[model samples]
Target: MSGFFKNAFLIAKKDLYSELRTRQVLGTMIIFSGLVILVFSFAFDPAQNTTKAVIPGVIWVIIVFSGILGLNRSFISEQRNDTMQALLISPMDPSSIYFGKLLANFTMILIVELVSVPFLFLLFDFHSIGSVGYFLLVLFLGSFGFISIGTFLAALAANSKSSEMLLPLLLFPVTSPILIGAVQATKIILSNIEKLPDAVAWMQLIGAYDVIFFVLCLILVEYVMEV
Candidate 1:
């Protein structure tokens, strides 16, 4: 158990350090998210009261796209210097590598979401932080589902001729459920609709999706890496 954790931590730390040094992945994500927000602000008239109606969709769209950007680059650092091949050849269990990469990607997604949420509120002038806790919980759960499938897909597509294009094609459809659940939950929370049952159902769906994908990705990652 200790050995597993040790290896995972080491792998995660290496990725973290590389990200800190280059800031390539995160910088692009933040800039892209900001630009999306800016475009929406001008493209739609904020004074016309359409902002609230569109804010939820806009926020989720930015998150989903930005997530794809981050996930696409998740394996770039490793592949750039041929480190991924070395890791695959190592004695450590492949599951550890998958988990470690997933953890790092999860952290990046969460950070991007965190930074973008405030920008979203500011851009659309959403005053009431109604159900902020629920919003964050939904984000975390949704992101977990995304990262699980994304990590596996990223690994599988990393060496492809057009990995950048292939990943979103494969990942977007598989992860759509989580995105739908998240968007619905956000809509309910933002509108302050008092129906607890609907929100609960959405949350349950997100949780189930997270669990299923996490296990599925774990099992498939080893096979993908082997191939």
Candidate 2:
């Protein structure tokens, strides 16, 4: 078991190192998220109650879209360099590749969220009335579920001719439950302190979503890689 994790960590380290050298995925996510936030900040009246109502949705949308950009490229780089085949033929468990890629994708998405989400809140003049720790929890659950399945599907779709378009089409519908839970939890936290229990309920749902699908994806990704 320790060896399994060690190999996964090495794969994740390799991906992170490559990303640091290129900055392709991280740079695109940050810049795109920033631009989206800027556009929305100008389009809505921050002081308006209507804007507050919509801010949670907008914030999550930005995060997921930026994440999709990163997820779309997660496996493509391996395919392009022909390392995917090498990795597949390696002695390590195939699921380790899925896990390693998931780690890398989750980390990058979290970094983008940590940077952009505060700026997004500031731009909309919004502040969380609830616990900031819970807010981060919501973000963590949402990102984990999204990235878990995303990493698997990315490998599944990486070889497709229309992977760019195919990824979002497959991803969005499948991820809707967690995304909805995330948005509702975020809305409650941002808008009403008294609704903390309600937010917690939503968080519970998202956490369950994360656990179920994450395990399912881990089990399925090995077969995916075989094909």
Local distance difference test scores for all models: 0.83, 0.88
Q: In candidate 1, which residue pairs get closer than 3 Å at backbone N, Cα or C atoms, i.e. clash?
A: none
Q: Per-residue lDDT for 29-110 in model 1, tens only?
A: 8899899999998888777765677777887787778888888887766776688889988987788888888888888888
Per-model TM values vs. the true structure? 0.95, 0.96
- Per-residue lDDT tens digits for candidate 2, residues 67-138, read 999999999998875989999888888888889889999999999998998888899887655778888888
* Candidate number achieving the greatest TM-score relative to the actual structure: 2
Task: List residue ranges in candidate 2 displaced over 4 A.
Answer: none
Give the distance in Å from residue 179's predicted Cα in candidate 1 to where it truly belongs: 0.8
Listing every candidate in turn, what is its Cα RMSD in Å to the true structure after a full C-alpha superposition?
Answer: 1.4, 1.1
Model 1 alpha-carbon drift over 4 Å, by segment: none
Q: Evaluated with lDDT, which candidate comes out highest?
A: 2
